[model samples]
Target chain A: AQSVTQLDSHVSVSEGTPVLLRCNYSSSYSPSLFWYVQHPNKGLQLLLKYTSAATLVKGINGFEAEFKKSETSFHLTKPSAHMSDAAEYFCVATKGRDDKIIFGKGTRLHILP
Target chain B: SQTIHQWPATLVQPVGSPLSLECTVEGTSNPNLYWYRQAAGRGLQLLFYSVGIGQISSEVPQNLSASRPQDRQFILSSKKLLLSDSGFYLCAWSASRDSPLHFGNGTRLTVT
Candidate 1:
């Protein structure tokens, strides 16, 4: 079975500080990984996706994630945090089986102003 | 420039009432549609997906049923609502299997 684990349920960071949210995935096949952000009652928006092209994937809002194949980890990072960056982040993986995707429990990011 | 739309942004219904949530896609053709329910602070649980009109696949066994009456319209229906059914319902669409999904603003359903 394919699944994603988010290391932190909640992460607090000060404005202008670096932010890191850790995620680990387990898959039997070549996986397609993605990061999504949901703001309050709004729907989820795709951040970035890793389709085995590049190890370092860049996304919107000065956010990026590194795919560590050796460690089976895809951790999201940002050089600086803004108040607008506060949202719920989810790590997702798709194994191309039954056209289904696995979603993480999500990490709530809080930016302290 | 495709967009997905889900109606009834917020709904409050009494128990045992029939529930219907409508979703439609525009600017896309023959897209795959999906319906998902999110519990409080939990990940999304996929309820149903449709590849095309009249083709619906269920991911989880539940009291709800889905129908794709048109190429770009998908509807989720429950004959009798339960309190457990109260959650945020999201509608999403993808161009294909390899494409990322685009979600609409979800409908917050509260079955009181």
Candidate 2:
């Protein structure tokens, strides 16, 4: 089974400071990984995805994630945090194309102004 | 551009009431549709998925059911509402197995 685990349930960071949301995945084979963000009472938006094409994947809103095979990690990062970045983040994993996706519990981000 | 739309952004219903939530995708054909539920402060749970019209696959056993009446249309239904069914329901679609999912705004169902 493919699954993702978010290390933190909540993360607080000051404005303009760097942000990190850690995630580790377990899969029997090479997997596709994704990061999604959801605002209060809204649907999830895809931030970025990794499909063995590149280890470093850039996404919208100045977000990025690096996939490390050895570490079994795909951690999301941002150079600077903004108030609007305060939202719930989820890590997702799938075995391959056309496979069922599994989601992590989620990490709630709080940007301190 | 592809877009998914879910109806009844927010719904409040009494217990034992019938429920129906509809979703449709535009600018896409033969898309893979999915129904997911998110309880307060929890991860999403996949309820059902459909690869084509009249084909539905359930991921869990629950009071809810799903139907795909058209290529880009998916519906979530329940004969009777339960308090446990109160949650955020999301509709999503993917172009293919490798493509990322695009989600609708979601429906907030509150069962009273």
Candidate 3:
């Protein structure tokens, strides 16, 4: 079984400030993790993914995440938040070569100008 | 280059009415397809997934059903809609089990 846990349900960041969204996962085998963002009334977009490659993965729109095997955590972060970054973010995980992708409860990011 | 398409961007129907949401993938063959429902303030919930034609695996028991009539076409259906089914329905496709999923612009389902 594979599952993900988003530590925060909501996060607020001011424009030009740093942002962080914490996530953790549990899996019986090596895990494939991902970060997706959903804008209002829009589809989910893949921000980045970790497939047992580099622990620190860079994604689109100046976002990045680090996968810590020891801690079982993959946390998303950005140096400066933008207005367009305000959206619902999801942490997803799946065990090696499994079609079952488990999703976290999601964290709503609010960007303040 | 691959793309996923979902129809009926928004739909509002009364309870007990039937529901159908169509999803298709282009430029990819034998891709893994999935249907996910997201509710307000809640996360995404996987409803079904298919690896090939006529092979669908349901994750949860609900009033809805899924079908993969063709290699690239997946459909979500329900004989009777329920208010509890109101949410955002997303269609996604992946090249393989460990590949990243590409999602379509979801369909907004509102069952009143």
**TM-score of candidate 1's chain B against its reference?**
0.98
Cα RMSD to the true fold for all candidates: 1.1, 0.9, 1.1
Please, what is the whole-model Cα lDDT of each candidate in the order they appear? 0.92, 0.94, 0.93
Q: Which is superior by DockQ, 1 or 3?
A: 3
Instruction: For candidate 2, give the docking quality class from DockQ.
Output: medium
State the lDDT of candidate 3 residue by residue for B38-111, as single tens digits.
88878888899999999999999999999999999999999999999999999999988778889999999988
Which candidate, 1 or 2, would have the higher DockQ against the true structure? 2
* Model 3 Cα lDDT, one tens digit per residue, A1-113: 56789999999999999999999998766688999999999999999999887999999999999999889999999999999999999998876565477889999999999
Taking the tens digit of each residue's C-alpha lDDT, what string does model 1 give over B6-88?
Answer: 98999999999999999999999999899999999888998998889999999999889999999999999999999999999
Best-performing candidate as measured by DockQ: 3
Error of 3 at A64 (Å): 0.7
Winner by lDDT between candidate 3 and candidate 1: 3
In model 3, the clashing pairs are none
DockQ for the candidates, in order: 0.63, 0.75, 0.76
What's the fnat for candidate 1, on a 0 to 1 scale?
0.51
| Candidate 1 iRMSD in angstroms | 1.8
Indicate the docking level reached by candidate 3.
medium
